[model samples]
Target: MISCACPEFALDNNPDTRAAMERITAAEADLLAARAAFYPQLGVTVEYNRTNNPMYSFGNILNQGLFTNTIDFNDPGTTDAIQAKGVLQYRIYNGGRDAAAMDAAINREQASVFDNETVRLQLQANIVRAFCSIVQAEEVVTARQSALEAISASLAVAQARFEEGSLLKEEVLNLEVQQARAEERLIHARHCLSLAQRGFLRLLGLQGAAVQLDAQGSPAQEIPANPDINRRPELQAMAAQIRMLEAMVRQAEGGHAPTADLFGSYQVDRGAEFGDGSGNSWTTGIRLNYALFNGGRTGAEVERAKALLREAREKRQHLELACTLEMEQAVLALHQEEERLKVTAKMVTSARESARLSRLRFKEGLLLSSELIDTENRLTDAQLSHSLATASRTIAIADLRRAVGLPQFNHGK
Candidate 1:
């Protein structure tokens, strides 16, 4: 018998799980970007304007003979102007648009968080399933190897009897054939074990990492009854989406409300000859603007927002139904697989004993070689069935955990 325990497989150390956790970091970046909208925006401008023929001569003509009548029309002078301003434009009041937008951004960030959580749960489920498969495959390899050894012993006995002219050549051939078949099964089981190992490694996101599986023990906990779906990330994400949609609706409605902003500006101008060669002036005031009408555009936008809200509500309902059905199915499958595993375990023991007795009887020249071969084949089938049943049960339990929003292989006793 193989003495190794089942392997310890958990998503806590998986690279995919780690990557999902990093999504929160990205969400934080988005939150920062959204908050920046409340800050002021600054702008600077520089201009070098040159006019070949200037209109300043008109003002000069009007001042003709007033002081000194001397028409000195030389090359038009170029005006080089540089202006810099620090603008502080904060929405003192907006039809609640800014608040709605900020709320929407916050909701979206929350949704991202839930999405990451859901991903972690999925990874955990996959890892548990793959790990269980590896264990089951290892058991199969061991069982097949044991059967091959038994068949080898029987074949040797048959050959010696044939050399002593007590057993026919046909009997020896039958035993050899059974031994070959056992060898084939062992080879196939080894291949299956290799495949399972690769699958486990891939699920852990350790594609190139050098790792070996250390079998632990069978899962100790049973599936929970009546899982709380409210804690599920999928449901939480849906809730966040609904909140985001509500924010969008409010933002659209805010478009119809009045917006207030405070503005101030200063300008400096220099003149060549007219009166007041240089002047500086500043003005500050509050402005209120409202979109009185826009050819039904704002009204259509509000309708569209409402339509989207309805769609989101419907989607949430559908998801709730789907989750409920999946949970039920997973629970049923787990029970079924558990029962099958128990039955197959019993079958393996009975078949092994029958094969051993048949081989011993054939060696005593009391049973036909054909009977021994039949028993050996039955033993192989029972071993394979038991292995498959165990693997299926493990997969079912992992799926049940996922359906109920529990961590993969939580197996918390």
Candidate 2:
């Protein structure tokens, strides 16, 4: 495997991160729409009509400034009229419904931001876990390879002694059997390493790309003395959701009040064709709307909103508890991995010394072949254990940082 720097999330193009970013963009669009509702609306419309109806013909003729005593009131003839009107409308009051909508949008946008952050942090942890797994698997392969080599060397010596009639045939056969087992172990370790590498590539969104690792020794950071999940993005996101739900409740309540709006319009009317007649008019007024006969819809909306707010509040409590538990579990895992690493390191040292001494004794015909084989196997196991412990500790560090809403490897960045 080629050695390379750790994968960058921004470069990896993780689908989850991309999806989260899109959600944030959507939330921002909603916020913009909410803010736009606060401003006055201006629009233009054109209306054209041709009619012979007595009432409409008289009105159209009057608007066209062609009304006269000569006009027949009972059976006015056909008339054509076109009006180009420009209208402006502004909401003067809506019982704070618009304000509540704005607030809700603002909170939703905030929640989206925090949700994205939470997704990024969790993905980072997963990448670290995958990366660590590959490193540990590779180390195990190395340990297995070393074990196989040691067994081969011991078997060669046993065969040589048996050829000279100085060692029992059973002893040489034992060495041969152990050598085959060692080869099997090595093959299995390599298989596992390959699987781990492929998994890492998939996690990086680089399915067919080469596998590599920065192989920077485990993070040097220790268990945090003050484990705090207050800054965890998941919890913050939930808090924002709760606030958004509260605003929705307020918006539903505002539906009970009447709405007032200020409106103004200017119109230019072209009268009967080929008559060189026209009329211009301007009007300004206020409009009020009261939903006096809705069948309990407003009340139902209010109740539904209140129910959602209560659910959000409960979810917030549950989210906080879940985050706290995660933080505690991460801390304890870090401590446990730390102890395991230390223990494995000691075991490797002792086993290495024992294997070295056993090899010397076996060479001098003072140690049994079985004893020498056991020592070599212990050394290999100890090495593999140490490697796993190291990787686990590194992963634990990343997990703890994720729980605290910190960066994966580097502390601040």
Point to the candidate with the largest lDDT: 2
lDDT of candidate 1 over 293-335, digit per residue (tens): 8898878888998999999999999999989898889888988
TM-score of each: 0.84, 0.93
Q: Could you give the C-alpha RMSD of every candidate to the true structure, in order shown?
A: 5.1, 2.2
Clash list (residue pairs), candidate 1: 5-215, 5-216, 6-215, 6-216, 7-215, 7-216
Tens digit per residue, CA lDDT, model 2, 1-413: 44545435433477888899899999999999999889999999999998889998888878778877887899878888899999999998999999999999999999999999888888877877888888889888889888999888988888888888878998888888999999999899899988998887676666677776767643455555687998898888888888898999999999999999999999998875528678898999999999987999999999999999898888888888888898989999999999999999999999999999998888778888899888998999899889989989988988998999886756443
Please, what's the RMSD in Å of model 2?
2.2
* Worst-scoring 10-residue span by lDDT in model 1: 59-68
Point to the candidate with the largest TM-score. Answer: 2
Error of 1 at 50 (Å): 4.4
